[model samples]
Target chain A: MTNLPQNEANDPFVDFSDVALRYGDENGTLALSGVDLSIKKGQFAAIVGPSGCGKSSFMKLATGLCPATEGSIRVAGAPVTGPLKITGMAFQNPTLLPWRDTLRNVMLPLEIVQPHRSRLRAEYAKYVAQAKTILATVGLAGFEDKHPWMLSGGMQQRVSLCRSLIHEPQLLMLDEPFAALDAFTREELWSVLQDLWLEKQFTCILVTHDLREAAYLADVIFVMSARPGRVISTHRVDIPRPRTIESTFDPAFVEIVQKIRAEIAQVRKESKAPARPAAQEQVQ
Target chain B: MKAKHRKLAEKLAPWVVIAGLFTIWQAAIFIFNPRPFILPSPALVYQSFIDYRDPIMAHALFTLTNTLIGFGLGILVGAMLGIFIGSSRLIYAGFYPLLIGINSVPKAAVVPLLVIWLGIGQPPAIATAFLLSFFPIAVNVAAGLATVEPELEDVLRSLGASKLDVLTKVSLPRSLPYFFASLKVAVTLAFVGAVISETLASNDGIGYLMLQAASQFRTSLMFAGLLVIAAMGIGTYLICAFIEVRMTGWATRKQTQVTGGG
Candidate 1:
């Protein structure tokens, strides 16, 4: 157990060995199967696959939002029974609380999760400062007191990012967190994420369908099959750190993206040939 | 400057119309040979205020208290139950239709029965207010609470918040703007309940006083009572509007807070 924590910190934080998941009692389709993966501590790993693949399933498993039907999954040397406290998330759209200003929205988790929750009243100032600092990190400093509707989409997204990282969790999950943004804003946030990850060195898991996004951000990229989504391949990104949009133009990143793209095409082709999925968008 | 002028024009138009209507009424009363007892006019509505100021004020206070109290309780309880129903399917399935059935029954139909059960008094009166007022609060609150974005809930959940936390922090907070909106409607309904109950059954309220003046052929006093009830209704309505404005500075911008899909 002692070596486990250190090994996690030194090597990787979460390990999924032969993980499998399914939805209901009808022996319905498997969302994921035979998924063995490890996201190293302080690493930015992205899961990119075709739509209908279990990229979201992988996210749910990591956060303990759902449990695997079979196999051993562990995070920080502990098996995930339910959601872990040491994680934070942001979604595609900037879903800031319309009732709260940007700062209070960011401080939401801190008031809910323990230790901080117990001390929210006493350490409100400190937490506010922390939220402001994170808002500043994402370039949302002066807009902290402004309500969510008053801000533009990009700004609201920045607040979302700030809210995710405000508590400074050990792991941050991003489920297509930038899919809703315009190209320029997406690129801007990519840098902001990169800077935050590099500074904090927190473990991260990002789910996206955009190949360029995976190639730009991930230290390792995992591709999954389309339906009974299994890990088709894991490609360790050999790109250097501190990457910019210019890095996306690099030959190496392009090659890796192309390779993943082909695998995704194959998976999608196979998925379409099989039996029809009754519900296309099963709320992931 | 042009924008500001248009905004001011939008606000000024309504008052100008109201002033015009009152002016026409004044002209009619003067031309029609109005007496103190017959068509005493808008002046009577005002002058009656100066005539029976103390008694009308006391009755207004009495009616106002019942409405405000019952309004408060109905809203508080209805909102809690509405959120409960909206959040859980089991509760919603069991209770929601029954709530609808209850609301569909005209509240005035049950006042006599309420008096029988609770004994012709404040309890019956208060119950009357609660029944009339609670429907809008409960319905609107439920609709508002139901429409919280699933994305927002997911964000909170992934942050390791419990279901209760998601409720209080995300769902409940998000529901507040809607609650305030429903609250506006609830306040008016509350006044309706109070005034309606007082009109039919009570002896001490402005509604009762109006009934007394009409029976005694005291037209001026009847007008006075009506002016007081109208003022009470308007006053209560304005208080609700004020509370909505003061509390929901964050709500006006949240179009999602209105009853609709998020």
Candidate 2:
């Protein structure tokens, strides 16, 4: 954590080089191709693109949930051959186990990932306290005993966030974690996420459809192309720390959102028109 | 409280329906003074029950023991087969059709075959009970495993959870409700299977007692045996339901209508 910006210039925490993911065997659908991405340690990165783009495929490849057909994916200076132990993932659906209470749901990762798994029983009280503390940060302190179905969509997402962060993983992968929420709830969670990221400073990769969400949370926003998705452009947000909903209206933030929105609109139009319109294969 | 009132009503509803059914049965007997062998009144059945209580209890206990043994075997083998089939797509595809084929053949028809192989007695009754009950449990358990949300699996797998971890923590617990639901069904089917095999070939059991009563034209005794069998079925069903509620109440909490203010 010693001035990571200065030290992280040479060595990246997550690096993908000429990565391509082809589903099935040869001549199958190509989900991603020629995708190269590098994110420094503790940097907040966002990927925004139209629907059907391989934004999610990138997350899978980065976390090693699925293997890449071609190219190399290295996270934390180690090549990812399988699911990495150092990563936490939250999906669009809260996906909390209904049988488990909020506290237990948040503690799920501890039951799997070690040394927490080994130490959990002996240090049960300590871990419960830790889970409670994270839940409090996400505004879920008093509702620890409630089941997932008892909580509303927004609160369930909060529990999901708490669960992902409970294990204290080095990399956090979020795939549209707030996409299902209403606008206001989504904005509130954006702040909740921002505070968590600011405090922990863990390397985060957020795949989002919301342009403003990408601009608000990400340090570097990567706009991907349509299917066979590759990073088309990356924009660095210079907006200051602890950005509020009000800061989103500021010209700097507004301009970045509009620019990315326009790029996504262009990608969406191109994808809709035809599978192959030009042999030129332009790169912006 | 309203919930208490509802619970009381739920507990009494079955008794009220049973009483009404008995009343109609008695009226039928009064309206048509048919021979006692044709249809005995509820009072006559009750009288026969009191007269033959000792033998009835003996046979009832025998059938109950056989039913339980077979039901237990069904659970063990069915659950094991279910886990084996459900956990892997290849196994599921291969064995699912075979299971359906075996299950499709009525257990009553299969009992004679079992009797042929195992010889006329408790073995065939137990085998028939196992055959009848195991299919539902296996199918339900496999369904439970198969229906696991892919997103949940992805979440667990991303946490570096092993296949065993996913199965133990998620798949097994997720299947509990399905297992219990099928238990209620399997228990009733087990009674049917046991009685069918007993009627066909057995030295003891309520089914054999009822067959003896029928041959002797002691219709009241046969009806009494029927009542005992019904009572056993209902009792086992209630036990299964109670355990289901105790074990996996979270699944049916919505139907039970918990008004949690979370």
Candidate 3:
């Protein structure tokens, strides 16, 4: 493994250096390339890009679901060898088990994660209390006995968020977790998520295509190029904490969104140009 | 409120229809004056049921016992094999074709073989029932496990869950509705298999009783035996259906909504 740079070695929670991923075997398509990223502990970062730009792939690598074909990924100062148990994840769909009720769904991770799994049967009441508290924190107090199918899509997503946080993981990975929700519900959840993040302060990496969402929630936003995706630009938001829907219209916030949009537009243009022979040769 | 009335009516409709059919048959027989041996009226069938009640009860008990024993063993073996095959792609690929081949041969052909291997009594009846009923349980279980959402599996896997954890906690529970559905079908098939073997070789089940009644030209007694078998089939099916509703209420809530809407 290569030695970390001096600053990165100090306090970076997640460090990726020259990371590249190719799907399939030796001659497969390169999904991401030449990526170097660092996120500080407890920082909320967002990755925004055009569709098919490997933003989701980056999240997979960070969580150790898939190995990077090249370079190294370090999360919490340790090399990610396999799936990291310290990370919690949620996706566009709630993905809750239909057979399990909300409380059981929220407690799912506890049944798998260590210390908790061994103690769970003996201390089930305590675990249930913890799950109930998390559910109540997310405004799902009365819905504990409700099945996933019984809940509205937005409510299901809320339960999913609670489930991810129940284990109190060090890192939260969200892959477009609210994209399937309505605009109204989407905005409402932004505050719910923001409140949770404020209270818990877990490190978060949000992969999303919505620039407004990124501008509203993230401490910093990273924009990526089209396929063989690499972070093309990173913008740090200077907005104060506890941002609301009204703050999204703030000129500084709007400017940040527009700047990121412009970067993506530039990426789109570059992607549309006829491919260079050198790039074609490398893919082959 | 209207749905509740409709549900009550739906439950009563089948009995009403059966009664009406029996009434029509009695009227038709009275007016046409058919031979007693050709078409037995419900009255005559009922009389025969009473006259042969002792023997009928004994034979019915014999068939019911064989069916239950065979069905239980089928379930045990079928579920184990189902889980094994469902958990692995290689086993499913290797065993599925052989299962299909075995199921395709008419079970009647196998009844004689079973009789030859194990004499003409409870053993053959039980073996035949097992051979006929296990396939649906295995196939449905495999299908249920195979169709589990990849997203759900990923959720458990990301949490450091082992393969067994995923199966017990997620896959098995997800397959309950399918398992129960197959059970209903398998129970009916088990009855068919038991009777088939009883008709071919055994001397002590509803099938044998009906055969003896036919040889003696006692058609009403034969119809009585048929009615008894049908009743048993429906009873076992209701039990399975009740269990299905209790165990998989989550899976069928949407179906209930659709029915209630209509």
Candidate 4:
């Protein structure tokens, strides 16, 4: 693939201009709208907002998993018509197939996505070795062949992470992939995820409700409003790489989290208020 | 060696149970105190079984072939059609109602009708078995296929999987457990169909042997024929059980494959 010059890549990885996401056909209810964002290449961007703020819908638009109803979405410099292969994803649930063992689950994407899919069996040994290495990196070395139900919640989520990164796509989209885990596990995965991003600079869009997670992991965190979600604030997390829990306690990081939470609380307050009174008739 | 010992111990328990059953049966016959012609002694029954063993074996082989072929056909067609229906909403909506309606019909009533069309030989019996067994397999497999984890579908779609790839790789493999689960019921039902058809009219089959012995007033021989029929049913049941175990041993959470989905 020929490289696009810096000017062309003003927003190479993901661009959504006045994007609107809606459910159902014409005359159906709106989901979200007026979403304007441009994520630069190699940026660890996270979308942080309340539960129903269309964060997941923004994810769908970015990866072409779902199309925008009224606005344009261009990912990697192409208009997304359907699901794109260059973007990898992990959802809230680790939806591993029950029939396959853990190692096979990790190898599943390579066995499907081309040009690797076309030569999977022939290069299987090499791919397996890579899988073992990646599994080891995530502290899941010994449980490669165990069925999903046999593993603990954190362990299964680790496998889910491996499955998403197996293909090493240009972009990684995460939709609350760690919400179900406990505090310790979630913090541990944050380190692993941080190390992975450090090594491979793929453009990542993380959709999460955890403000702390957003501040901890993201270089850029966009705070969206309540339903009909609009981006109201963007915080640049000026923290150093390889950060730890202590960093989360730092005044700067804590202040960012508090600010994002307050923004969300304000949005909630505005949403619940009575319908606005019309401006009194005034002479023009 | 431990496994072999376990097998032997398992085999011993059943034999001990059957011997106790035999003694009770023998005692019950004596309690009735009927004449030899009406209710033959256990010894007489055993001897008749030995005398008719070859003809019984021949008829048994005939019945086995028909039931196995028809059952195999039913499973294959049922599984394919079930997957197709489960994969598409339009197909599921259109075919599911028709399938239930067909399954509710009196399958036995159609045997004579199938006979008139296909001739009253193995053809009709095989057809009868197919008709009796296919619906359960189809319905169960379709249910399993439909319930395949949607999350896995998302994974495939994200990986640029074609529609056929999703169906064949994800949907089809996911349904095997359900397909095999229903097959146990189908095998028994298919055996019943074959036997009932054979009893209705057949030149030579275990069912025909039972009929002939009854007509000739050979009570002991008829009992022996009945014993053979029971053996065949038990034997088919075991075969299906073995296959289910061998194929799905790894697909189950329980390491022992014999007691899975079925």
Candidate 5:
């Protein structure tokens, strides 16, 4: 027991070892298998993969929304038994509560996560200030009182990002948070996210199919194989901080994106032969 | 500006239609000169309204009070049961069939049982109204909770929100529009239940007055009783509509563009 504690203490912020997830019953199809990975505290990591490669399942496992069928997963040095309190998540849809204005939506996590939850009513103004500051950080400062429907798509996503970070969780999980936006808005949000990450330094795991997004935002990129998905290769982005849209066209950035794309293409080819039957079954 | 004018026009349109209807009714009565018992003229009905104003008002007030009390209790019990059944699939499966069976039995049949159990008065009227109105509230509330976006639920659940917290904070608020919409249906049904009980077992209320008027050949008084009931129904419906709009203005704002022509 002492040895186990010591080992956990030395582990990274997020550590997944030989993790395999099978959906539904025991005989269910394996979504992911043999996934060993780790991320240092405060690091930004992105998982890029082809569609249907179980990238989302990896996120679900990390957040404890879905349990792993086999192997151990630890986050912040504690084994995940159920949904973790010290994590935040944003999705592609920017699912802000339609009834709540921007500020109220941002303050939602505070109403759920503790010790903030217990103190929220007594310290309501203090929490509102915190939410406003986060909203301002994401360029949603003046729109705090507007309902989600009143805002544009990019603005809604910014509010969503603020809501996810309001409680200041140790880990931030984003599942293609910018995929729904136009290219211009997507790039703008990338920088907004980068700035937020620079200021907060929370560990992030973004799952996306957008290679340029993975290249621009992540410190280290993990390219996933076709399902049953695994981290097939890792690419470190050693670009200096404050990198912008101009930097995305840099030779090094282009090369890293091309390399990952080639690897994904290779995985697709290998998995193609087996996937046909599954595709047919799905159609039927 | 255009939208505001259109809304005003919509509000006035119903009154214009009612006036036109009354004109045609009075004209037809003048032309045909039917017997008062067969069909009273609008003038005679107006005379009855003036003569029996006190009795009509009293009976109307009594019916309204019973309907309001029954409606309030129905909302409370129905909302509780709805939240309970909606939150868990097991409970929903167990209770839904039982609820449907209860709702299928005619509330008229239940009124006699209520009279047998509670005697012939406000209790039976209230019970009948409650039985008629509660089903819609229960069903709508459950449907509202059931239709909550899975993404929204996931966001809350992943934050370690308890089941109760999710229901109170998210599900309940999301269900407001549906709840209020069901109230419109429920309020009308509640009137039906109240009048049914009043006609069968109660000595008070517009239904009883109408029954008495019918026996005495006071056809104009019976028509007057019906008009009073209709006016009261409209009044309560307007109150419900006002509350619904105030509580769920956000939902309405989004769909306002689709609400042209009324």
Candidate 6:
């Protein structure tokens, strides 16, 4: 515990250096390439890009769901070769096991990750108490016994968030977690997510198509080009803590969103051209 | 009150339909005055049922036992094969078509081949039942496992869940509703397979009784045997449905909630 701060300061929690992922044999879909980026310890990073820019693919690579065909990825100063135990991910869909109620769904990670998995049965009461607390944080206090199908999409996603955080993972990966929700629900979840992240300060990476969402939640936003997705640019947000819906209207926030939107639009336009961009094509 | 009334109506609907069918059969027999050999009246069938109750009970018991045994074996072998085929793309690719090919060759057609290999009597009946019942279970279980959402797999996989963990914790549980569904279908199919084999070659059983009655021109007794088989099929189907409702209630609950205005 005493050496934790120093350990955190020395290395990026997630480091992708010249990473490339090809799906199949030699002539495969090159989903991601030259994805060199790093999230500093406890930083909230958002990745925004055009459709099919491999944003989800990047999440897969960082989480070690699949191995990069080229280059090295290091998380916490160690190379990532397989699925990392220190990370938890929430996808666009809630993906909650319909059979399990909210409390059990939230407790899913506990059954899979860590010393927790071994200890869960013995410390069952303690874990259940912990899960209840997490669910309350996500505004799901009274919905514990309800199955996912019984819950609204937003509530289900909240349950998914609680599940992802239940293991208290060091890194949280969210790939368009609120993309499927209605606008109101999406905004509500953005705040719910923001509060959770603020409370824990886990090193986070969000892959999303929503620019305003990226601008509102992320400390730094990475913009990527289309197709053989590459980080085209990076922007730092200097917004104050506890940024709200009002903050989204602030000129600085709006400007940041507009800039990202322009960048993505440009990328989309470039992708439409028959000729692939030279800069992105050249391997780093 | 309204919900309770609806529930009552649902339960009575099947009984009413059955009674109506019996009434229609009786009327048709009375009007046409066909020979009992062609189509026995409900009363005649009932009389035959009482007259031959002893033999009928014995033979019905034999057929039911064979069906149960074969169905049980089908569950085991089919579940194993389903898990095997489902867990690996390679095996699924190689064996799915072969399974389809085998399943497509009617169980009735296979009964003769089963008789040659296992000789006659209970062995052939049970083998035929086992053969007929296993295919659907295997296919359904495999489909259940195969159709597990990729994103859901990612959620577990990212947690460092082992392959076995994924199968046990998610895949197997997810496939339960499918397994039960297949059980409902397979149970009925197993009955058919057993009865078919029994008819073709057997000393005793409902099928044999029906065959004997037909040969002796005891058409009412043959009709009684058919009625017994029908009752057994419905009974087994109901039992399967009851168990399915109990075990995979979550799947059904989801569907109901969806229809009840989301």
DockQ for each of the predicted structures, in order? 0.63, 0.85, 0.67, 0.57, 0.77, 0.86
Residue runs of model 6 more than 4 Å from their true location after superposition: A1-10, A276-284, B1-4, B109-119, B254-262
Steric clash pairs (candidate 6): none
TM-score for all predictions?
Answer: 0.86, 0.94, 0.93, 0.88, 0.92, 0.95
By TM-score, the better pick of 5 and 6 is 6
Interface RMSD of each: 1.5, 0.8, 1.1, 1.7, 0.8, 0.7
Cand. 4 Cα-lDDT: 0.82
Residue B27 of model 5 has an lDDT of 95
Residue B32 shift from truth in candidate 4, angstroms:
6.1
Q: What is the lDDT of residue A47 in candidate 2?
A: 93
Q: Mind giving the per-residue lDDT tens digits that candidate 2 earns over A1-284?
A: 23445555569999999999999999899999999889988899999988889888888898888999999999887899998988888999999999999999999999999889999999999999999999999888899999998899999999999999999998999999999999999999999999999998888999999899998999999888889898888899999989999889999999999888887888778788857553223343
Give lDDT per model, in order.
0.80, 0.91, 0.89, 0.82, 0.89, 0.90
Residue B213 lDDT, candidate 2, scale 0-100: 93
List per-model TM-scores for chain B.
0.86, 0.95, 0.95, 0.85, 0.93, 0.95
Ranking by DockQ: 6, 2, 5, 3, 1, 4
Native contacts matched by each model:
0.80, 0.91, 0.52, 0.66, 0.68, 0.93
DockQ category of candidate 4: medium
In candidate 5 chain B, what residue range of length 10 has the lowest lDDT sum?
A: B253-262
Candidate 3 structure quality by residue, lDDT tens digits, B133-232: 8989999898888888876776777777899999988999988889999999999999999999999998899999988999999999999999999999
Across residues B94-190, which tens digit of lDDT does each residue of candidate 2 receive?
9999999999887788877887899987999999989999999999999999999988898899889999999999999999999999999999999
* Clash pairs for candidate 3: none
Most DockQ-accurate candidate:
6
List model 5 lDDT by residue over A1-284, tens digit each: 11235555445889999999999898898999988888977889999988988999999999998899999999877899998888899999988888899899999999999899899999999999999888888888789899998899999999999999999888899999999999999999999999999998888999999999999999999887778988877889988888899989999999999988888887787787754332111100
